[model samples]
Target: MATEHGVHAAHGSAAIANHAHPLDPLSAPEVERAAALCRQRHPSEQLRFVTIALEEPAKAAVAAFRAGGPIERRAAVVAIDRADGRVFEGRVDLAAGAVEAWTHRPGVQPYPILEEFADADRVIRADARWQAALRRRGVTDLDRVQIDPWPAGNFGDPAEEGRRILRGIAYARDADDANGYARPIEGVVAVVDLNAREVIRVVDEGAAPVPAADARYDAAAQPRLRDDLRPLEIAQPEGPSFVIEGHRVRWQRWRMRVSLHPREGLVLHEVAYEDRGRVRPIAHRMGLSEMVVPYGDPSPGQYFKNAFDSGELGLGRSTNALTRGCDCLGEIAYLDGVVAGGDGAARVLPNAICIHEEDFNILWKHTRAAGQTEVRRSRRLVVSSWATVGNYDYGFYWYFYEDASIECEVRLTGIIQPMAVGDGPIPPTAHRVARNVAGPIHQHFFCMRVDADVDGGGNTVYEVDTHPLPPGPDNPHHNAFAPALTPIRSEAESARTVNAATGRHWRIVNPSRLNAVGEPVAYALLPGETVAMMAGEEAAVARRATFARRQLWVTQHAPDELYPAGTYPSMSKGGDGLPAFTAANRPLEDRDIVLWYVIGVNHIVRPEDFPITSVHRAGFALKPWGFFDANPALDVAPPAAACDCPPGECVHGHDGHEGHAHGAAR
Candidate 1:
């Protein structure tokens, strides 16, 4: 980021385009060309570009594409005219250098541009009322204060209606690199109009003094360091066991194509696995559609803290530049992502995605009484990326295992959003972390969209749960339990929650494909740590992000229905995405379907989570259920010997007649 007007601006560089794959991201030249084309048609200096990225072709076109075939390249663009607050959408044909379509969107607000954040900071700091409020808290130095502009959520205030607004949160900093979050200036909120670039109101409710103590965790600020740790290293002598061509990856029996979306970040397409000599498709596309972080506090300074990270602030644009040994280990492959800044100039972020393989201890091991032992190692392919949105950091990891299972994990870590506390008893909704500093309770809910094609396209979803039978004719001993499978026949019955007491799971099966025992080939979704939305049903947070209210939702596959939250969630009223799509009550049995699974983490702030938080993980898994005849890893070879022991001694366990007893060490 570059410093401009005492605020950081987004980074980018101009370049040319020479794309090879049709699904590849839009190049720098394409972004510049698209913006220029829009500017020509609009002919206004007030137009600011919001989003500029590659417009993906239809699924049929991508499926029929060959290596050097005819391609029709296009770009999707969104811009807003700052003068009248009118939003525009356009499409550009790169090859012909022509505008394909241009339309105006009424009564909608797109995501905020990166420059507006800086502009908001500049405007708030210059306001006399904001300065007076700061002086009332005994803070006079303006340069040392940090002002963060947050999306001002709609609350039905007539004064703030039909206007773009941002709330300002301020903190006192000791130095340039010091932790500003350690000292929050609470009870002062600045409401600023983005288009007008002026402070609308400054509310000062309390006079809590800022904490003077500094909480710096850098090595230079520490007095001593640990000296008893040893370095551990991992190496792959023969290199990795996977092959990559462009965006396509092949490892072991798994195959898929990876792409970077401007909002969704990492997206997987055509995920399939090979059994024997046949390739079977599992999913057509999978990615994180939307995620929300809603705070529990309802004070004047904290009520409007619910933010749609992926929709309001683009996760793909917030990616971090990962380092080699620090972020990943062993033999690793990196992929760069191209994204545009506020100026619609594309730039390549180096090492935005990391790919590697990890040894997962053991796949399976057994020892027989006949003095024979066998063990095989387990390995998984990992594709991961990280994004830092304001005061929090997030990691998205996709793991593919040898036994034909897929796991998607979300790791959360970073500085917690802090609040200033007085010398009274602490509030129940927060925990005191440092001197006069409190950490607020919050929840992070993530929605994953899986376009499943269980053997082919047509599939059905069933809710499977275990029910114990009564001790009548069914169970004489009163210990008989069996699974009860119920088909979800319509969208009306698709929204459901997890019943962990019954070991419940949802399965997607192809009714046309039968397994060896006449069962449908299927994959089951195993829910991990999850919770329902804590907000009330009528609350604005719950209404805007309705996907989080339920753990599982099955809907008919539609290309335009991508985001779990609607296309524009910033300051949205409510009742958009999931609720609107499921209103049709379409048939879901034996039809092309999509699964929307929500993972929730209820974060109760701890004292140890103050200065910086350790990684906290939450996600779900998909396991093959009746899709395979037997164990898929049965053909995996045994691991090589770790020591120079004789071959027979390593595997042969001693029986009653001990002959060369095997040592405890492998």
Candidate 2:
């Protein structure tokens, strides 16, 4: 008798057909017997039979496993269809003992039997290797390890599986914490016991956290001082003391403030005052005084121009036009001396001069030019750098003043481009370079300022020099045939011929030349394929300036010396007592100084800057490297208990919020 999909009369006893048949039938007793026989064949095996419904096999299997139990000690035996090889495996100890079977075809046995067996000793052996790998790789925390099962057809030996587990653990452990700390936890090791076929232990071998003073560095040599700079008794304001507008000035830690009439800009007051008490200059370290000059009653043009030229205000008799020129003027107010204010009488003490004319101008000019409306509203820019500590000596470096000033300037320049709204498209060439006359052409301008304090026990710092770009089609001054492409031809062939007309033009063409907007068009530089063009000459110039400044700072300050050189570049602490380029430096301490910078493109005003100018600014602050050594999120661990939210409404609630009432409880 024949029945359903693949059932038919086999022998007279109705045996299930194998291979060619659409369905095969085996009784529940037959399946159980096959399982028992396989277990017997592999005597040291711990096994369980896993049955999955045919229609929704994979999901059902995973759901059962996720309902977790003590399966770590047993091997999973899965039952699957002969046609499609999907297996449902689970922890052996968790599976129910009863066996059941079913067949799609009538007249066939209700269950189909397929037996698979694995040595329990092999799994145990693999777990041991996995544990060893974790120890070798310095993995200590098991709770944080993530496990991903191998695919069905590509199963591996226990050792290999253990390695995969260790790899996953390493990846999960290496992620940066929210506070940017990136160090791996110490002395932690994860181990597996092969014979037991289980993960035996998660060990924590890391050292105890210590305060900065107890760290390896010499703390006694670096004396600690109070943050305040006020003195005890003051003989009424005397000598050539100048009055400043202190109202509305914001007070900052490690910095002092003095106000000047707006019209005075950045000019220094012609007054000299002396302190009247015994003081330790080193105790007032990191304190900087700022003289804020308001733009009092000046013509708008003067105000803007003065702000722009503020970098030219303070060059002592030096006449170097490019390196030492100062055509700007402004009022100066900065922390010059430390004072004690106890004993009912304030007396002046030895002071640390944080700001000086030259260094101030260098910072002022660079920032002013970069952030000016006329320049920033036109270009897109990105700037980033790393810091190191010991360039001069072990002494603290006060480079934050210069960095902060520059950052403030870039903030004023404001170059962020507004994103297009929904359904709006970005211009194809918005980030591309200009081609010929038909497409839009963009021109960029840049100005830089550099200054250093000569009075802070250091010689005149060298002004950073920059490299000029090679003259070519993109270089307006050198490319002889650049003017011919006033209006480009539409046909690609015509443009190519025109571009290659002159042998000299061909020589300089770069065939890879990008359009004005920086997008790559059909050009023949590398094979016949089109590619994006290189950044324009203006960008190259800015890049050179930034690079030169970084190199000069690192070389001059090498982090191992005492009294590290003070410059915008010297702000970060590094290994060997210098600033670091990578994230591996020691943590930043309370007295450490930091420098920050921001730079971007400037526009010289073209039709492209219509409506309002658009500017893109990018820069970062330099702190002592590795300032965050611990896991920043560890302090915020979640509660262990589950929340009490009622079914549907509280599915998203976290564990601790269960019993907490929201709104008015009924």
Give the candidate number with the greatest TM-score: 1
Q: TM-scores for all candidates?
A: 0.93, 0.18
Report the number of backbone clashes for model 2: 87
Identify the runs in model 2 with alpha carbons over 4 angstroms from their true place: 1-310, 313-409, 412-552, 555-598, 602-608, 621-630, 637-666
Q: Give the per-residue lDDT digits (tens) of candidate 1, residues 352-408.
A: 877789999988888774446676779999989999988899999999999999999
Please list the residue runs of candidate 1 whose C-alpha ends up more than 4 Å from where it truly belongs after superposition. 1-19, 66-70, 641-647, 652-666
lDDT of 2 by residue, 545-625 (tens): 222112112122112222111111111111211122212332221112121111222222243332123433322222211
Clashes of each: 0, 87
lDDT, candidates in the order shown: 0.83, 0.21
Model 2: how far residue 287 lies from native, Å: 12
